[model samples]
Target: MNFLNVDIPVKNVPELDKGFVPLGLFFKNYQKGAAKPLCIAVERSGGQIGTYETKIYGTPEMEQADAYYVDRLVKFLLWSWGGFKVSICGDDNVAAAIRAAYSEGGSRAFDKGFMEQVYETEFIVESLPYDKKPEAVQRAESIGRHLDGGRIGFDAGGSDRKVSAVLDGEPIYSEEVVWFPKTISNPDYHFEGIMAALSTAAAKILEKGGHVDAIGVSSAGVYIDNKCMVASLFLKVGKDEFDKKVKNIYTRAAEQLSSQLGYHIPVVVANDGDVSALAGAMGLGENGIMGIAMGTSEAVGYVDTEGNICGWLNELAFAPVDGQPDAMEDEWSGDIGCGVKYFSQDGVIKLAPRAGIELTGASPAEKLKEVQALMAADDARAKAVYESIGVYLGHTLGLYAMFYDIRHVQMMGRVMSGKGGDIIMETASRVMDEEYPDVAFRPEAPDEKTRRVGQSAAAASLPELK
Candidate 1:
């Protein structure tokens, strides 16, 4: 398939999404041209800066393509690495377009607003000369793996809430409670539910003759200092009530529980992505790992070569994947060809009808269950859906290689459940071997059964009690 000037020898293509072009393959072929220098830098909290300096096509005929290419790169960098101020050095036209798009009433208003809320700062776009460009901080701080004393680990999800009462490194009690947090608008529902979960876990810890030392929360969304900046669990909540109550709900719940327990219990809330990475790292005893969970959406995090988790957003759900101009659009971010549309249960639901499977489930998760049932029946159509995702992953890893120094890739979530997941991992490995010979997803996928901690339970190691 020819995308722009480059031709990609893609073997396994999605039947429905035939126009799919892997961004990694496309970029790899593009950079082999008369690429010019361009630097994209982003500054986040604590003035931490992350820079991606690369070559862009400088040919006069490729002006429009240059803009599209640069824009996607910046978008990927922002969501994956994260930043409030985007500094574009050595490109004026591309910078101008970004400034206009990120403006108050532009195409990327949603992304800009989300960043502002996350970093709690006004977002800015600046175009600078290469000489005046920022340098890479690449700050990967040591986090998680405290695993001491009495702790309550809570994982907040859109469908259910999971809490584990962990004493030392082992969990004394664990439970999963189903609730509809995404549909509820009242902050009290959230407050009461969180309190109930914490209270239940506390009772179990007390039964084990332990007292709450720390409360650690593993959750989705961008968190700044254990505060809810933006989360899907609070999607229905209004800004007024979110600020008034939901902002500090986790800590407040911990505080109230502490008041009852008669002890000062500090709570550390880390993004589930980071916790997943930490879990995978601990499980494998390796670093330079990137964790990707295909659940309701695509969640990702990285553990750098130094065995440290970076402070970046690692929100790959919104990061672009397919280079197809008319690729599938994500409902939340309203972005096309993103990971959420290709790597999550939504990807399965999108492919089901095309693969001749009629799904009648009301929710995305339930629809995924239907597909898994078909896969278990050795349905060829179900296999086709997973093969397409495998093709998507095999190519996207090349794109990810452009940024991260990856040694091992850890996969998780409901989308990766059952035999279908095996199809994805196996097919992806084959694609890597055939197409990206050098891009290695080494040591194979880690065994989930032997994992040190479940994705949510990993939060028990987040806080180091004082």
Candidate 2:
């Protein structure tokens, strides 16, 4: 299929979605001939900057095509390597397009508002000079994996909370408790639950003649320096309450616990996606690992080659993968063929009908279960859905490789739970081998029984002791 008057080549097509065209492969061929150079850079918190140099079709007649290509690229780069202020060096028309699209009431309005909340600044896009293009400055910290003395590890989930007490890199006690953080508007419920979980874990450690030294949290959201920036866990919490009680909830909880314990317990909270990558890196005993968790939506984290978590926004859910205007649109982003639709439960549900499986009127989670159950029974339709996902992933990884220096990729979350998971892995590996053989890095999956060591040991290792 053509991408707005541009021909896109495809070596592998998803079993269910024939219109799938990976951005990575498209870029490789898109910049072939008569393309003009374009430089784009984005500046985020702490003056961190990410820059990309791309080429667009150069002609008055192809201005629309240039805008289309640049718009998607800027959006992808913004979500992949986040920034609130964007600088474009090249064509004015495309730069104006980027500015308008990321502004109020534009196509990326949700992204703009979210980034503004995350960075606490107005989102801006302007023109830049080619020779004066800013260099990339990333914030990558070697956090986590402390595993010394008494440590508390907490993973806050929408449906449940998990806590673990680790001593010298070994978990002494761990438990998962069910709760609803997303449905309840009362931040008190969340606060109480968080406190109870922390207290329970601390008690477990104290019973073993240990005390809390450092606490690390892994939760669904964006966090900077252990402060909650933006998250779905507080979706129902009122704006005023969230600003007053929730932004620093993790830090506040630790302070209260410190008062009761009669000693300061350092706490560090990282996005769950980053913690997942930390888990994968620690599991593989290597760096440059990207962890992709496919649950209700796609959550991604990256560990650079130096074994540090890059502070760039890895919220790849909104990032494009399919490059098809007609592909499935994300419910939240209203963008077509993004990663959230291709990599999450939405991807599974989208393919079921095409595979001749009817999951009418079922909850999304229940629909995933129905398909997984069918997979267990060796249903061909279910296999088709997974194979399609596999195809999507293999090429998508090719796109991911363009941005990340990935050495290993850890796939986790509920979507990767059943035999279908195996099919996805095998099929994706095959596609990667055939289509992206020269590309660096290989995808690896941890065992199903104990994938990434329950994330406790990893989260427990976040903060360094003084």
Candidate 3:
């Protein structure tokens, strides 16, 4: 796997400094031959060059003429400046394209070093694929299956904070939950349990002839770069040892599983919410979108451009409100994060106590069921509570819209759907219209197809597999 660094050289100091243009990336990989890059970075300036950014959705192979036209345009721009210059970091194809674009019949003119190329030992930025969307997805899926046993994910809860190995969008393997027993005294208990749990999942995957791709942990916290846990919210694991310990446990489990399965594969350790987002973002269904999971705490998520789960997508808990600047932190903190304090199950409980509801008589889940019953009965009090909760939910969702730069927000967990879903959705739409008339917010129900596809894509990203 080689990388290409195509530098679009320009003279303007200001434009270059600002990284004005959003360069498009395209590349091709071969099975039996060397991989080559079909690269181009077209920069437009406000002064001499007109400022314009257009997109070509198809690939270089599918849209050969379009790619060629782009190549020619880049060459012309380069020559118009002084000479066409490109830094080739992959195969000879990068150099060849420049030569062809600047040749005698080519559009650009060059005196001497028009096609001169050099091999520099520096980090280069190669573009990601922009063509053959279906094919690219298929390739990614294949890679996922190859790397892991169709699983790559994370999970977290009260005493169950662990990464997972998912396949076909299901948790086939998981890291052990760290139980924080009130009467317990041993420090190693949590770590030992987690290791054992991870090993158990690994053993199960290997038994099925499925490989291990990546490990994703979902807990009550924030994770970044799939490497470190920012705030483990309610988890007992410290921020310091999360990276090292999780990796070590996953590595040992993968090795053990591979030995048992007669093969070796790579593993990734990540946060659970991100994995849930990956499951949702890969189009799990009609609502195949923004994943908001609330258990001990709440987390909002979406898949990023890198095909990885991202918990930092919205962080609506930290969002600032207009009339109440500190409402986000003051109102939406502690047990609920953003969802509960305003919209989730705990929010319902909070409302319950205020409305003389008997929430103490039943289990939390059962109590939630009762809330849904109240909503179904069309009780005026329950209706009002649900509607208000819906508004709060929508407000958070609106934040998701602005942050992700996307519109559709999928509502997950027990609190957002079923008997209360319609009320919540209606309120979300209404509030979105009131707060942000310019944006469109459509809520969707979950489905199997999107989940399967997302899982497939995530699974395809597993590395170090045969």
Candidate 4:
């Protein structure tokens, strides 16, 4: 793999310093009978230019998959560089392959509407002409004064929802209530449950003579323009009701709560992964952080170098991580070798039986609990489960590095809860040091208090709060 740095001129570009960076991503399969790698050229304001190239090698089908992966990597890079308005330049074949992959709806489907949402630009099959009209750039919502006065932060998880009453970046009150979001088919159940939780938090603020100014939400699934495009929370609802009622559930719930409270507050909802990344960034006081939560599923969020969350679909759970022909299959997507199978609690449960440990529990969660108990007692079989996960982490981190200039990865979720978490991080670090020494990055896990505070505080900061 060869990486060359070159300066390329972009024509008729608006001044980037006006809050948006312009980037051109080029993909070429063969150049002079040799496979040309994925190339990205970025131009910021003040006459600055940077180019990045990474080699690609595989058969036609594999290379096509690589293109999809490269597309995701380019999005991450451009986001980290700063807010970007990107132009994708590639030949007819590259463009068609990407379009087909996204259309097929599998591991390659995550980037389906990515270009339209994040970059506000389209993919050009032919060579990009020097002069093209740039689309009107929309600046991200400002977080200014959102975190100040009083705020309610909520994080909706698989089994429980967490609510926090925050005053100027500090939580005055917080609580967790268990709710059945997945199995409930009625949208009213979800609506009532969510509003009740927020009401509890709002009451705390009012008790202290503080008025609720805004509500920030972090939830699992895809959110576009503050609406739930696809989420597990509404999976059981009928298609018609899911589309009509459950789509904007959060915003609607907020409005109802606002009416009851006799004041209208701005409401902001974002992907949980992005909130986790934002939390990690806030906790560390740094940028370029990718936060991966390995709980019921693998959730990912990234904070770019400019300390802004890129609105890209960081749905890395379904993103392909292993290219081997016989990788483990995701039961949900039936795709081979996805990130979810290796990063979530499901990953550990799947590996339990393989390690020759027979779990007598009835469910996967119960089986996971048994494994954690074994690890607590220093059982070798339980230890091996995490060690293998460490190995997975090392390899996946290498793969992730190809796409993200990740400086720090904050590992959260149930899988990283106990002694098992320590072993996983230790072994992964050793693997990276011994096997992938060239990769310059480190992984860290936050303490319990820090994790909770960071999560709620970051949730409060989502509307771009100062």
Candidate 5:
């Protein structure tokens, strides 16, 4: 049984005149003691192909020791296709480990930055038990569309829910309502809260004589085929009830709202992080953008050059960014040195008391707010928390570059509010310029109105309503 088999389509092949090449890697599981050699198949988009294989002499664990085989595979791909942009499809753990190796850099086979040139790579993992290929979906056309009448868009965050009435890509009315999805066990509470918010937004638009045309939603967690697979919002709901009812809660709510309104309005749902990236692209009018929302946890999304959302898990919160032996552990996932520990509100709150700045609030969010308020007053301890975050961002940007074709990074969320955000961005910029000058991209935080309204507007653009 070959461990790897890849096939590249002909249309993606780059011509000699083109500046870069596109490559694909299909990585299968590593069998413990299989005698079958590891194999890689490469072909021109024109159908010409050849097989490359190497024998494995040890257990799968031994083969993965120090990521030896992973390093060889990456080098082989780069050698086979020079200056190529690669997409990897494989097991989640293996892909995570390999990607971490590229940035964490402890391999002896290559120099520390040997893989820097081929940094714009993406990893797609099989989501299901029997999935043979990575997930890819054709994105809806044109994130910006003119709705002659009106549309309702909702962005559900961990702490609050934002609803807006949008027309012609501009939001006319918007409101943010606080809700406790994480702590509330009853799904009915969440359902009722969402419907109430949407109802309020829709009524405002209708009062202005503009009929509702469609509905769009942006939410946290893994959404596959418009169904919530794993989400923190449903954490309190039992597995049996969640799987049976809460999984497709968005669609159900949309249907109920449409029936109540006495019209069939099309509803489209997307990941909140993806919506954030779309919003950033719309705000900046640029492509190849990545959006990071450092709020309750680190949420991430990316938009490719063609402005299409890649349908992979872009859940960078759990993705490892630090490879040091003594990295900090994420209390939720128990994973060491993930993006969550460095780029989240929790990260700030965690460091606040440690920095000797006493927090007056009970919850993490409140504690973070207290620290931010202190930073506004030029408190040294609070300032240090943000400065450390800046350093973290600067170093992690280099690691993120290895996976994303990042040209513009838009930073948002509660953690990036007010004076604290400025400190973080300024320090991060200095770090990038001084330490990793080779990295060409810079991080920017959009204005408050743009960050808030633009996200809901982007949510409005998720569906293709004919």
Candidate 6:
């Protein structure tokens, strides 16, 4: 459950081309009525531990007695390599019994051999399961049977909590749990909420005797390999801890869920847009295809040639775009992001003033509709706005192609709704064709079923796992 903090020295040896040091030895008896002793050695500072099993015979026979002598030899060698000072060897009851019998008996059977007390220290070790699976699943399923199928729900924009259980391909159970909230001081507030939702969902699945295949999370941030948190619209929970927490929860969730379901399986954690990409890519018959969801934000993910996940990736806002002098795409590009900045809701807001079109609410979809009607009358500003959105999307996709060798790009979300999507797709296609003459760029829309499946699949692929 917890790791020990130990200080150990590092040394280099020149003569024998090796380093030598002393180490502490601890022994434990795991099996009942055992004649031989199962032992383990731990460095004094506890940085490492080595385990070995040995059997000592009653008769001091050269061949058989020395046959099991490898144990002591191995421990000594390992301790020496670690640069520890071995003063005396300290062991538990079983180790003591074996040592005493060997010492007092002395001949072949009586002489179990020599075990010098290399170090004397009061340290202890205990036995624990490597992990618990299958059983946890059974327990979770038992709980599920008694429930009314309510699942825990989370508000993407707020903290409204509810429970809901939907059984599509797999049983997804969501629940509410306590979590530390993020504030202005912690800009990743929504990201924290996403993690909390995942944790509660994991717990619920475990409680209901169900196996969790993967968890897809929708957040206002970015995802990288090893589950690294690149940036967030809300919080600043450094990438180090973000990766650590996500991995830890993933392992715990998989083990517990598997145990409840009575099966051992791996679980994946992924960003929502990445999941969206995966689901969208399923329909595309290409080796490497990516899906980009351009909305209030942008999320990108790809499916490899074999259908394994690449990753749910983002943080392209900071990516540089061509033909933009002295400008970072996120800040200086005509839009906030080349593609998302121009095509998303934010893009809509910025373009309204230039086109002399005013939207009553902050909805990009509503604003776009208003802009479309104005443009239908051949308004130059309105048409330019939509055209620019398409051109930016095309340019961004062209850049992505260079990095991933991607073939088809599936577009989704409000950005892909109606006429704007068509224009964007046309622009993106033109850019891809111009840049990579040999490659093909196809665009398509994603349906609901594929979206759900893709989301879960992408989530299941989250990485930096133990």
Which candidate leads in TM-score? 2
After superposing candidate 4 on the true structure, give the runs of residues whose Cα lies further than 4 Å from its correct spot: 1-146, 452-454, 464-466
Model 2 TM-score relative to the real fold: 0.97
| Residues 1-466, model 6: lDDT tens digits | 0001112222211111122111110111111122543333323222333233333322343223233233333323332222122211223333443334334342211111111211223222232222311111100000001112222222232123222333333436544444433333343443445545555665666576654443333333333322323334334454455545532433454465456557554433344544455555543434465767666555565555555443223434323332222222344222212334544666655656755566775555577677666666666666666665655565455445534556567787565666666665775566545543455665566656565444433333332123
Better of 1 and 5 by lDDT: 1
Give candidate 1's root-mean-square deviation (CA, Å): 1.7
- In the predicted model 2, the residue pairs found to clash are 144-461, 144-462, 145-461, 146-461
TM-score of each candidate? 0.96, 0.97, 0.53, 0.78, 0.72, 0.48
Q: What is the Cα-based lDDT of residue 35 in candidate 3?
A: 33
- Order of candidate numbers by TM-score, starting with the best: 2, 1, 4, 5, 3, 6
- lDDT for model 3, please: 0.43
lDDT: which candidate is best?
Answer: 2
> What's model 5's TM-score?
0.72
> Residue 253 lDDT in model 6?
43
**Model 1 C-alpha lDDT per residue in residues 260-297, reported as the tens digit of each score:** 98878999888888888888887877888888889988
Give candidate 6 regions above 4 Å deviation. Answer: 1-168, 171-228, 236-267, 283-286, 309-314, 326-340, 358-381, 430-437, 447-449, 452-466
Whichever of 1 and 2 has more lDDT, that candidate is 2
Error at 359, model 3, angstroms: 3.0
- Please give the lDDT score for candidate 2: 0.86
- Record all residue pairs in model 5 with backbone atoms less than 3 Å apart, i.e. clashing: 10-45
Alpha-carbon deviation at 206 in model 1, angstroms: 2.0
Worst 10 residues of 5 by lDDT: 12-21
Off by over 4 Å in 1: 7-12, 442-452
Residue 148, candidate 3: how far off, in angstroms? Answer: 6.6
lDDT of 1 at 65: 70
